[model samples]
Target: MKAIVLYQQGGIDKLTYTDYATPEISETEILVQVEACAINRLDLRARQDRPEVDPFPHILGSDIAGVVADIGPRVSEISVGDRVVLSPNISCGQCNDCTDGNENLCSRQKLIGFHTNGGYAEYVAAPANNAIFIDQSLDFSSAAAIPIAYLTAWHMLITRAKIQPGEDVLILSVGSGVGSAGLQIAKLTGCRVFATASSDQKLQIARQMGADFTVNYKKVDFSQFVLDQTNGRGVNVVLEHVGQATWQQSITSLAKNGRLVTCGVTTGNEGQIDIRKMYQKQLSLLGSALGSSSELRTIIQLANNGMLNPIVDQTLPLSKAQLGHQILEDRSNFGKICLSPTLSAE
Candidate 1:
């Protein structure tokens, strides 16, 4: 089997494509023949030796879509030859958080690609519970892109913020996978959506995805634009993922009692917060992580029903994993970048 191995965490160049022994499946796990994998900011951070990186020679990928080659002995719900999407979130199912359906917050949680080997390879063995079966109608590329960005956006807006129809929502960085997903989810709820991107082309795509208004943050102050558009009331919800760079503006663009839910900080991590403003406005600041398994299922159902879809920017062979990582790091790609493990072996 061939895999993208991080020989040493330094830069995108460290991601080398090489052959490796196939992993053995545990009793509760299933062996998946990976077809497609998606590039994520997490992958970039891990490659650069961010604090999130595990031990050396790590396989970095989280979003995977593939076919089950074999199932472990106790895996009763799934079988061999099943088409599946890997969930990436691994938790101790017996823990209190897991039992309560908050697996993302479990104390023993370990995310694939971050803490363990991931799907940047021909095959991966994951817990049977982490595999979600997909119908033949969906292509592997689309299925591979759903696990991270879509799930994170669903958990932030729908689960945490409780977005309602007619409400105003502001999504930052419309070019990002999560940003695109946020736009689609807000639109699905019939909310008036405002999205920010770095370029006119990306903003146009956001409009096609149902953003009511688009702002090129590189050209204008997004917070002022939001206030101007809403007659000073500001937006009802702010879907934020960009960290220190946009945090202050996101807060200022919110109306009184507005909800701000965020999951990632691709920019800097630390930011200043006005305690007085927070209290006076009675604002709700919610920090969300990757969603639960249930939310993943809901996102898939939404896709299956044609209410949502993955915005794929480009697809490359696994040997070009370094190039995919470079595209993500440069922030030039407008949506998810997918990689084909099978093509990497060629």
Candidate 2:
């Protein structure tokens, strides 16, 4: 199998496209023939340095949608030729957190692509239970976009923040995968959305997606803009994933008793808060990681029914994984960028 193998983490140039042995499935795992895989910011981070890249010659891609090519002896639920999307989170089912339905919080959880070889290749092996069947009508690229971006956004806004109808919500980096997904989720829940992006084009797209207010953060203090828009009350919830760069503003843009949920920190991780203001406002700060497989199933159902759509900005051949990483690094895309292994020859 041909794969983009990372011998060492440093630059995009380190990602070598070469032939490697196909992964062998264990008794409880299945081998998937890669159809489409989505590029994520995490891929870029792992490519540089993240400490989790193990066993050298690693393959990095977590959002995977593929066909079951081979099933393990113990994998009775999944069959070969099944159209599926692999849940990126692999957790110990016997752990307390897992038994309590908090698999995302399981201390022994291992993320696909980060902790093991991922979908940057023609074939990859995953736990059989991690595979979720998707409607054939849904394209592989679209299914590939759902696992990480949609699941994270769903967990943040729906599960963590617990946003309600008619409330105001602010989403940072509105052009990102999580940001775009959050926008759709907020709109479906009947919330008035405030979105921030670095460019006017992205802001325009947000407005098209039912964002009530859009701001070019590069031009002004988005927090002040949110305050002005909401008549100084701020939003009920703030979907914050940009980390230290927007931490203070996200905190300031929240209303009294507002919930601030964050998933990632693309720009460094240290942020200071005014303890007095936090207490006075009764603000809630929440940290989120990937969501449970059950949540991913709900997300897939929504996608299948057309209630939620995965916004795909573009598709690149698997061989051009380097270019895909570069696009994400440039932040030039409005939504998820996908890689199709079937298009590699093209």
Candidate 3:
């Protein structure tokens, strides 16, 4: 099997494309023939320094859409040749959090590609239960773009913030995968969306995706722009993932009793808050992780129904995984960047 194996994490150069043994499935696992895999910012951090990379020669890709090439003896629900997308979160189903449908909070949860070997290869193995069936009409690349970005956005806006129709919602960095997904989800829920980006081109793209207002954070204060747009009332919900860089502004951009749900810390992690202002405004600061498997299922259904479209800015061959990481590092893409084993690097 051809794979992007990381012998030791350092830089993009460490991601070497080479032949490796195909993964073997346990009784409860399934071997998937990789069709498409999506690159994420997490991949870059893991490649650089985030101590979660396990075992030697790790394969890094969590958003995977592929066909079931073989199944374990105990895997009865899925069979060979099934078109599927593997849920990135692997949790202990018997835990209290898992039983309560909050598997993202389970103590025993493991993220694919981070805690285990993942889909940067011709074939990879995953738990059979993690496989979500996709419609025959749904393309693999699109399905591959859903797990991390869309799932996190859905959990943040729909489950955590509980945004309502006609409300004003603010989405930061509307060009990245999760950011773009958040923009779509806010628009789908009938909210007036305020999006922020680093470039005019990304802002234009955000407008095309239903953002009511767009601001270039590089040029102006985004929170002030949101306030001005909303007539000083600010927004009801702020989808904040960029950490320390935007934390103060995100809090300032929120209305009284506004909810700010965050998922990632692409910037520095530590953030300070004005305790007096937080109490006076009655603001709610929420932290969200990836998402539950059930939420992933809902995202897949939405994609299948065409209610939510996973934006693919570009697709490269699996052999070009280093280039994919470089694109993410530069933050040059408007949406998800995918890698396909079926494509030729040339």
Q: Please write out the lDDT profile of model 1 over residues 1-346, one tens digit for every residue.
A: 9899987888767888899878899999999999999999988878886776664678888999999999889989998999999998999999989999999999999888788888888998899999988877788888988999999999999999999999999999988999888888888899999999999999998888778999999999999999999999999999989999999999999999999998878888897889999989999999999899999999988786767878889889999998898888778888899999776335
Clashes of each: 0, 0, 0
Taken over the whole model, the C-alpha lDDT of each candidate is 0.90, 0.93, 0.93
**Candidate 2: segments with Cα more than 4 A from true spot:** none
Tell me the TM-score of each prediction against the true structure. Answer: 0.97, 0.98, 0.99
Cα lDDT of candidate 3 equals 0.93
Error of 3 at 7 (Å): 0.5
Order the numbered candidates by lDDT, best leading.
2, 3, 1
Count backbone clashes in candidate 1. 0
lDDT tens digits, residue span 115-199, model 3:
9999899998999999999998889999999999999999999999999999999999999999999999999999999999999
lDDT score of residue 168 within candidate 2 = 96
User: Model 2: how far is 65 from its true place, Å?
Assistant: 0.3
Q: For candidate 2, lDDT tens digit of each residue in 234-325?
A: 99999999999999999999999999999988888999999999999999999999898889999999999999989999888889988999
In terms of lDDT, the poorest run of 10 residues in model 2 is: 337-346
Candidate 1: give the clashing pairs: none
